[model samples]
Target: MLEIEQFLHWQRAIGRSQNTVRSYARHLSQFYRWLAARGIVWDELDFRQLCDFVAVLTAGLPPLPSRCGGRAPGTVKAVSAAVREFYEFHRVEGRGPQDLVLTRNPSKLPRRAHSFLAHLEHRRPREVSRLARPDRQSAETVQVIDFETDFAKLLAAASTTRDRLLLSAQYDLGLRVGQALGLRHGDLNPMRRQVMIRRRDDNANGALSKQKTQFIVEAPRRFFDLYAAYLLGEIAHVDSDYVFVNLSRPPVGGPMTYSNAYQLIERIGAAAGIDDLNPHMLRHTHATALAKAGWTAAEIAARLGQSHSASADVYIHLASDDLAEKLRTTEHLVWREPQQYRLKGDGDGAR
Candidate 1:
């Protein structure tokens, strides 16, 4: 068996992230078990034997292994890396030869491709009508209105009207969970009908305007009205700063945590008969709504603070109704016959 201390030492020396090192250690330990099951010592196993072990690890079993089943080539590569690192450490320390760690090119292995198209079809099929299964998330139409209504319900159920405004801000502005929770009082501009999102790190305020970039989300008039009510109502000791507050009437704490936002969504979704409601779903609904309203993927990406619109492609599937309408419009433009007129030379000269 490989020495655990040496493996961890090598991982730390290589400057790997804590999460990554933990994952690598787990995969290598699993590899050790598979080797032992076949009565082979890891150090004594040849390169060909290692390949066989990998094949066995990936092959379909009756019940399938936990977390390891259906692992992609990338996962296989990760395991191989951990094994190689362990052997290499031994070799460099003079306990084994350098050749013991077989170095094979990972790119040569068969790659596993995840088809987003198939995922979309299975999750929300375009052929299915919305009315047939209104509860089912369908690609036939973007579910923006459903999201809006559910968000409204969440606000009403909130412990305070401020919480309600915060929920409204997320759906209305398409703010990410982090951005929504990090909002400050200065962020909201009622007259401008916009909010500014300042980025933070480590659940604490980092450098002001250092890692900070501002994003503007269109605040509906209702948001302004709600904010006014929240400020004027029972919330005593109201702080001039911080748009969102904790349960306390006077804002003793800063903005809400991201976890609180997630729990709020879960609670609200359960109340709205949408058990799977999530922040990203609201973002998806926003993207789908924009796409249907003739916004390009790039525009949607910019508004959502994404470096690329590739992630926004999932919402494109939700624009099936818009696509169908566009096709109907195209039919009239291209296939319809035009009225014919006889020229002067066809029958008689112009009078």
Candidate 2:
């Protein structure tokens, strides 16, 4: 317990966020409990015992009768990773034996590295997960919400106009939830038909754009129409600079928090009968739409504010149907923005 506390403290000192620290602490705690029950020494844990622990996690059987649910595959992987880190930390501090051995795979060399830090990252031996099984997923198997069916249902199920805008904000422009929540009144440019994504650190609701620089998002005409309707119906008298604010809640004019946004998405998904949907799915759907429309990797990266074009390959490489092509045939958008403005085309792409 004390070792975990020290590790968490060091993690915080090294500038890890509170959420990340909590996750590491929880993961390490669960691992320690497992070790204690088996009368296993923390540092003396061998590979075979580690594998058995992972097997127990994979079984999703509750270790204690009071516990109700089983751990997901992702959770199993996370817990094992924490255990490995815990032992490594203790060993490095001269408190335990060098039990967690990391061997070079040589196969995972820089030959296949493509992204900015990919080569530098693979310069050393990668952490081969001996505990959890490999999560084998193909590049062509990307799951995204269908705009015409699932996404449309999600929009119609939303109770308020603001909620519809929130869904559209993510799907239409691939705006991150934080960026959508961080939106201010000044960010919306009705004349230019753009939304400025500014990176701010001082939002009262703690919402922030993930990017370091401000970028303009070209929004559809329907997006702006919804915004106008929302402003008139909900926050007509409310005095807040934030575009999306609490209309029915106690904080009458305050900006919507991340918790509020997440719950809204969950509720909308359930109402639309969408299985296990999350907010990021909308962003993925948007990127997949672009990729299906034959947008280049550089173009998708710029649109999504990703660090590199190689990162967009996953969306482009998917073996999807002609959904984007079909959607584009019906959709219409004008090229309009203040600084990022371009000459008008035939009005086919998302503005």
| Index of the highest-TM-score prediction | 2
| TM-scores of all candidate predictions against the true structure | 0.55, 0.71
How displaced is residue 97 in candidate 1, in Å? Answer: 16
Instruction: Count the clashes in each prediction.
Output: 2, 1
Please write out the lDDT profile of model 2 over residues 1-351, one tens digit for every residue: 687788888876775544356668877776777788889987688878877777777675445222335655556667777777777777789876675563335466335436787756646555665553444532223358766688789888999999999998998888988899989999999899999999787788877776778888899888899899988888889899998899788788899987788888989998999865777778888888887777889999989887799977665534424756655665555433447656677466766
lDDT of 1 by residue, 221-248 (tens): 8788888887778345655355656665
Predicted structure 2: clash tally: 1
TM-score, predicted candidate 2 vs. hidden true structure: 0.71
- Residue pairs with colliding backbones in model 2 are 218-351
Report how far residue 313 has shifted in candidate 1, in Å. Answer: 3.0
